[model samples]
Target: MRSLRLAAATVACLSAVALLSACDPEGTDTGDSAASGAPSAVPSTPAAAKSPAAKSPAAKTSATPAATSPATPGKAGRLPAGVWVDPKAVPLNAALHWRAPGPAKVLGEQGKLQIETLCHTRRDEYHAEVAMVETASLGGASGDWKADETIASYGSGADSSGVIQTTYALMGVFAQGVKDCAATAPGAKVTVVAEDVDHLFADVTLPQADGSTVVVHEFLVSNRGSIAELTLRADLPAGARPKTAWTAPADRQALSDALGKPACTAFKDCV
Candidate 1:
């Protein structure tokens, strides 16, 4: 059970799509105060596969001009071939509404794919509104990439037994930076409320130099080689903070389940 918590916390920390930083495996600090917003001495970029280094296979084809594009009578606004996940895959909530998927960004060299969608919710008579970015990634090589090695890049350190500890320390730096805009910036505070190897849950409060505070809840999950990240952000509210726990979507299971359908069934190699 403890391992599960660590996995979940790690996933939440790693799933922040907008704040992608490279991790180093060797330079991890193993101390009780490691989670106290300490700056990691490790390099920012990890040695694992860099998304920008890999080229997408789909980019080789030329797209037709919009003026001469063929219109399908029944299908409008559909994603071009090769993209995975749709709005239906988003989790439902009474207070939240799902937005359409954003433009797909292809990492040609890594053959990885990324797309984002937003879930919007309003706060107390429109004083503030929260927008959660739901980001998902599909790995290349038919999802053969090493999940552990990829995760290790985000500060797993050299001690295999302390994977959870190192992950929390590394993630603490990231959460602090996200709320305060800098890891070492003044008034930045991050609390690792819960974590595991595959998932993470964090409560971050960034007190700006301007006297305002930004609070956020971050959740992440990784199954097989695919990843899903959700970040909930809003103004610091009085009283208790809102919950931001998340579970993997059913359709996303295809990436891991060998007997299940793959994300890109149309591709022969995906099978």
Candidate 2:
């Protein structure tokens, strides 16, 4: 029993010596750790630690300006085609009424189509009046306007008037047609020479008796000759309710058919 106790004491002393060797006061590292390039006892870091540099360039450059191309020049202000405007709903206040002429009349067989518009006050006083004339050559392409003419005169108050002329040739649709018209307008000997017509949009302003302003837009073909016009007029009395105002003569049937409603309420939303 004495021999056995001595062997156990010697084993405990050997363990203490090993521990003391591992933790020397001079800072010796004895756990198989590397100081330089030797395998470290600690484990390596995860892939998530390397993710910051993997971001996209677009996200990092979000605040930079984009390069732009130069813009192309455009034509003068002209009416945009295919825009549907309801004639009856246009307000014919005193400002627009003073510039239009009396209703138009056709002159010859060459005049293929015509349209007239008139507006008057409740007491039969004429407020606005105008007409349109359209014609094409016998051999012209389908839906082509060889000649379109418009004449308009408008006035403000009971006695004001303004005048405008415009004509447009759809000859441009076919290169040969427009060239023929433009070449002939200068030297043509007919009463309605090609040069007589110019088609364009006109915007005019007329002043009212009370110092307010009224603006009018005319869609017409003009000639160097006679002018017959239409005027837009308003009949609402001073201080009258604006909501009670009425517009006239639009294709109510077309509007009703489009909305699947009765004609009486077809344009309830139009002002």
Candidate 3:
């Protein structure tokens, strides 16, 4: 679970958030994965990832978002190389240059990560009729890296709702898990900055395998029948962070505003 495992594998996401615990010294991946036994047909979510208002900051992080600066929305009507939203196509700052999204893959509801396993709160038992996930990431090419993890999921109404609820619910618990884990692990810190019922934002700092540390900005959003996890990770940037100014595309938000938007008939519909 070391390094949050983002460097090791690219999605299918913040499970729109999945992450490994920092327990393993060798960085063996564990927990927060949506790929076990479940239908690996769609992309999942990651927010650095995985919290609530009580467990999160207010509506914004310490970093102030630029008022006049609007983020660029995803490409309209552009189907992704994968099934759903293109990671590279999300709302982003127009000033910064970014690398294209990596390949998309399948990831779904995962088991407990090593840190969660050590958590005092007992896990819940909730099941869904269909759970399909596909994941991908967008990032900078070098120095001052900005990496975004996009996890999108779709399925039956109940399952999609369940996924969103569980994701929001777990964010708080995961926040605590990070602190407890940080007690023993150096250079690992997680903070839930801002949140609402449908979305969450967190700032995370994790030590890398190469003895480096990276800062990540994250968001977790829940649509009626879908979930989106977005993140921006960088070493040191020159300007304001992006998530502070993030806004989903109008088309996507319009669909999410409804009962079930971004409807997918099958798993591949995401990938």
> Please, what is the TM-score per model?
0.32, 0.17, 0.43
Determine which window of 10 residues in candidate 2 has minimal summed lDDT: 153-162
**What is candidate 3's lDDT per residue for 216-249, written digit by digit as tens?**
5555555443455555665533433433444434
Worst ten in a row by lDDT for model 3: 62-71
For model 2, the stretches where C-alpha displacement exceeds 4 angstroms are: 1-197, 223-227, 233-271
Better lDDT candidate (1, 3) = 3
lDDT of 1 by residue, 15-129 (tens): 8642343333453443434445565554577433344421211121112122112212353322123233333334332224434434443222222111011111111221111
Candidate 3: list runs displaced more than 4 Å: 1-92, 97-102, 108-130, 152-154, 158-186, 235-271
Best by lDDT: 3
- In candidate 3, position 51 carries an lDDT of 31
On TM-score, the stronger of 1 and 3 is: 3
Model 3 vs. true fold: TM: 0.43
The per-residue C-alpha lDDT of model 1 at residue 196 equals: 51
Ranking by TM-score: 3, 1, 2
Number of the top candidate by TM-score? 3
C-alpha root-mean-square deviation, each candidate = 28.0, 27.6, 26.0
Per-residue lDDT for 27-142 in model 2, tens only? 66745443244543457675544555313222212222210111112511111111112232323322222211223233321222222211111111121112222221111112
